[model samples]
Target: MPAHDPQATPADELSQARRLLNRVFGYDDFRHHQGEIISTLLAGGDALVLMPTGGGKSLCYQLPALLREGVGVVVSPLIALMQDQVDALRQLGLRAAFLNSTLDAETVHATEQALLRGELDLLYVAPERLLGERMLSLLERARIALFAIDEAHCVSQWGHDFRREYQQLSVLHQRFPAVPRIALTATADQRTRQEIIDQLQLQEAAVFVNSFDRPNIRYTISDAPNPRERLWRFLEQEHPRDAGIVYCLSRKKVESVAEWLTARGREALPYHAGLSDGLRRHHQQRFLREEGLIVVATIAFGMGIDKPDVRFVAHLNLPKSLEAYYQETGRAGRDGLPADAWLAYGLQDVITLRQMTQDTDATEDFKRSAHQKLEAMLGLCELTSCRRQALLAYFGETLEAPCGNCDNCLQPPQTWDATEAARKALSCVYRSGQRFGVNYVIELLTGKDDERIRRNGHHRLSTFGIGRELNAVEWRVLFRQLLAQGYLDTDLEGHGTLRLTARARLLLRGEIELHLRRLRRPERGARERRGRTVLALGEAEQALFEALRSRRRALAEAQGVPPYIIFHDSTLAEMAQRRPTSLGEMAGIPGIGETKLNRFGKAFIEVIREHPG
Candidate 1:
């Protein structure tokens, strides 16, 4: 080993980070990868940071821009991101500006002049803006200190948000050979990571991969008959009167859902590309400014948004890929507070996602890549193990036990022998000439005498009536398991045909044993009963928690914001558990700070003492 540097210490590193934090945004500590990533950039090295949302990635670049001598050029993909960051920097008294298509020519010219005058510390520009020869020459003329790429995963073809303009970002190094570069993204798998590095030409960059684990988030996947009903129930019970985003797969679904909520007397809005830009901006602003505003949208929303108090994010359909799923779910619980990350999954979600993936006209490599991602997401949905552990493992991390937060961890499921069900489903698919959809095959297997079944004569097949032991719902569940287990494949070209794979043959021949888990169905009565019983808490603790929440609500009202904006539900739960008696003890809670302690410390102590232990 080389000789150690006796002069360097962890204290020195921390002190440097604290100073930078205070100087730039008036903070005192780093969140997630902000410290290491900033240090790497300041040392004149490139970095690849894979942090979750609410992990303070902007600070990684902002602090380095303040520490460096010249201006830091930030290449962002969204104009809204530029405006938000610029406004926030101005609030902090930092000289920052942006150049984008949204700006008028005069404003753009003024921004360039400020850059050349060395009056601005950081300048944000879109990738397309940076590609212009005029902008390139302006950058060359300015004293460049650093080059930062935000949302760098967009450079990869495998990324869900791939943009062709991102391919030109590599020119930054050739044009400004001495500027330190850093590529940042909240979500990227191993494949996308390599593509980002290659496309950005950061071969020699120091990699600072942070943990993708969001332990504060609780992941739950529910298999219900009516997904929409289940989603409404979940929202009403867990996160009533909170701001959230619900993602539907199509624009039509977005509109209908938003209208449905509106009819039900909820303050919800529809958002998608089909709407006018003015309408989209209006809905986006309402969601940000108003509490309990639900925005139902397609995947076009929620990129680089600074909303930290999003209490939940629901997916009405499966996302395009696991990376997309991760990135979208990351929009929740960004303040290191407890938040719910939920998905109402079913058989149709799998079919819809797979069909969408196959319908795209891409190279064979891209199709196979997408297929692998879908398989991973499918496994996540159908997993009988811990959801948090499975999610973390996909990102190259390990969790040895249940996280004690998710649904599965709270109420474990039972496994059964699925080998027979798998065989019957596969047999029905094969006997039906692999030409029918899941519903038809399911009816055939259950020996239903429906018109379509008799018209197709599927009831006369050898596999028909063999599966009469199970009901229609049971057969549907079995088919979903078969799809998740790879025993069957859906033919996307023929209106989502159910086809048996080779694995199905082995099951039929008794050469392979398939194991399936028994899924629990929440009946209306049972769900209603569960809903009536509020969150489980002791009498004293419940009182204290309620009191703390009341105080939180008062403070939030005083500030004209939502209660969650002050402290998340998870933080309240922690306070209830600790029953902190002093300011120091209260400040030691996860999200409580000195400012908040000064504001609400006495109230919290009074609440805790008013109840019996």
Candidate 2:
């Protein structure tokens, strides 16, 4: 793998890549469209790759960076992300370094010397650093292999993680027109894809649209009355002693949740913009380097997280859009084990999001576009079919059937006529002059004679007290589904006032059928009652797995790195199940690259021998 060479055929380059994969990365074959994507890059062609999170996107660029002639200049987004990537590369015996503000000038100069001397295979530079005049000059002096623009969705204004600096990355294409460039992102819809291409100037790049389905992740959404207790249920029932992320919408939520969990004896940390830089860094570092730790964070966390064994991603509120939800939950189950993407959303989440979108300082067109995006996410919560199928469908990919993993597909939601109920609710709104929000209609239907209802004489309406057959909680569910199903609309100008849309008139006229799902009661005792005691392996083998995990943790602690960095839980599970005795057998294990085998093989093998199952 040098700076320049004669043309290599596809078969030749692939053979070379397979050899490198086994020798360096420890995997035997490429996952999904990885082989084709890497081959395209090695042949000096550009690509726009849309692979799901944990779909081995890193290898698409990392392997090519090694096979190409010059050092691969990767324009990454964050220092933490670069550090984690470089750490993984170094563990694989690859020469990888990232230049960011964290490095002292002397260290930066030394890394520059390494690059100029042709001693590095992959160089990770933040986009800001790469666009600087001095860094551009440094690249001019060194042999270039190709460029990889990671987290490419950051370049899209409509993307959840939009960065002003990333918008300027088109300079890479302009400056290095001949070199092949690959832009990679975990989550991007059709519009975002086009935005990425136009923003990055990769018009001619071969597009690779891998399926967005993460089948191993169990998707669950509950409109729970007590979201905190519901989240506790998920954490206790599903993921104990596993690394996971809990995403909140605001900094205050992050802090309170973190504190609440901490008081309850969970190793939880708060991460948001409100925290000092040092405090945020410390919390992030702890979350990475430790296990069984949950980080209650705003959207500020999880961009650069490379931890592979995050077993669950829990959300206390609804995400802004489907793409944001997809990206956030993707941080879980990266090791390809069974993971859960659990959410607790309600009508308030919808109302809050709608109001937020309408109150944005952007123009009406921008606000309208934002509202549409928010609606897509709300639709997911209202889905009665398969969560995964609906999610994939949003990205223009169709799942042939309901994924057995999501909650809806497993225990299909029960739908009732709800036509009479929907009409009653709509009549309540219409008879009340349709000037109130969802809460008011729900209150009137539930026969709650509050002061406002009594003062406004709203309780005397024909629709009022007509819905007493349903409780307040149940009525709220019907109203939410009505709004989501387009029988009702929110007046953003009226501050979330509920109004009838055209579809509601049909229902009122008895010319339309309406059905709504009954809200499922949240589990109150899963976490405390069953804390993940079951194992994929048998009793004897399960003991060996624990021992192996203990040993990995010891080594990771000694090295001051995340335990997954040493050996992912999936890999350890395989090792425990297989009961490899010798180094040769260990080498055959998945995730055992040559460098890791050389460094940690004998120790793990010895442990297996000492605790033979």
Maximum-lDDT candidate? 2
**Candidate 2 C-alpha lDDT tens digits along 207-271:** 99998888888899988588898787677667756678999999999999989988877889999
Output the TM-score of candidate 1.
Answer: 0.85
Off by over 4 Å in 2: 1-7, 523-535
Q: Which runs of model 1 end up more than 4 angstroms from their true locations? A: 1-16, 23-26, 31-33, 523-613
Give every collision pair in model 2: 2-69, 3-69, 26-593, 236-527, 237-527
Give lDDT: candidate 1, residue 570: 59
lDDT of 1 by residue, 1-613 (tens): 0111336464564466566464434355776667777777766788877777887787788776776678889999887557656755654456889999879989988888999998888899998989999999998888877988999989998889998999888998888878899889988888889998899899999887788888878888888678888877777777777678999999999999999877876678999999998888778867765567899989899887777778789998888677888899999878776677888877887787777778888998989988989999998888887988888888888888788988888778778888877778888888889898888888887787898777887767898888888888878888888888788888868487988888778889999898776766754442332211233467677677778888777876675544554666657877887888888777667656554567667877887877657
Candidate models: Cα lDDT each: 0.79, 0.85
State the local distance difference test value for candidate 1. Answer: 0.79
Best by TM-score: 2
